[model samples]
Target: MRHGKTFGLSLFLLAAGTGGALAQATVVTPLQQQYITAYVAQNPVPAATYGSEFDPTVGAVVPETVVLNQFAVRQEENRNWDGGQDAVRSMLYFVTPTQQTVLVEPGTRRVVYVMR
Candidate 1:
């Protein structure tokens, strides 16, 4: 009976941890997508050339060697453009060779959004 209780508690803890991560995940709306696309278009950067093995997707970790740039706009402008979401404003960005704009979380270097 004690072993059963321990297992149940362990499962509950694991679910709670996973739920927290899911809650923190970003959900880009169509309006936000348009904003991102326009922002990238207005401030062009040279596309990065990573090997074929380095395909970037949402939630993928970008390599440390790859250069990431902050959004070119001023903080106030960025806040307005990103709908005042600090999470969106704080992301680092890079252009992929295929013309996709990838937004990465600064701390994790993980791709949060890939705007095609």
Candidate 2:
């Protein structure tokens, strides 16, 4: 038990040290904030209802190939390739409020991605 505790502490410290090195504070101007707000508003999370309904294990899988395939499908559908072009028809990975990784459709805000 003691050894496990020590190992955990060491791992924590190592992670903390690394993260600290990359940590920097940034101040966003009012203009920047407004742009972000407008963007968020236009892309309103249609799937907000699925915000916390994701399976805890959903995020554990390797999403590389699947995610790429989805992206390709979207890109093919709309050659110009905008976020809304993909809309809410495809699957996407997202972090739930509970910190669980869940699959969702960002536009329509559904959890159907996980079950698929």
Q: Provide the TM-score for each candidate, comma-separated.
A: 0.67, 0.24
The parts of candidate 2 lying over 4 Å away from their true place are 1-18, 21-24, 46-116
- Go through the candidates in order and give each one's C-alpha lDDT: 0.64, 0.32
Model 1 alpha-carbon miss at residue 92, Å: 0.7
Global lDDT for candidate 2? Answer: 0.32
Q: For residues 1-116, what per-residue lDDT tens digits would candidate 2 score against the true structure?
A: 34334333433333354432221211223332333334334443422223233333411333332221122233344564333322222334443334333343333333322221
Which stretch of 10 consecutive residues in model 1 shows the poorest summed lDDT?
3-12
- Which of the numbered candidates is closest to the native, going by highest TM-score? 1
Instruction: In model 1, state the lDDT of residue 51.
Output: 74
How well is each residue in 34-87 modelled by candidate 1, as lDDT tens digits? Answer: 766877788888897677777797657789888898865566675465342344
**Which one wins on lDDT?**
1
Q: Which stretches of candidate 1 lie over 4 Å from their true place?
A: 1-25, 75-82
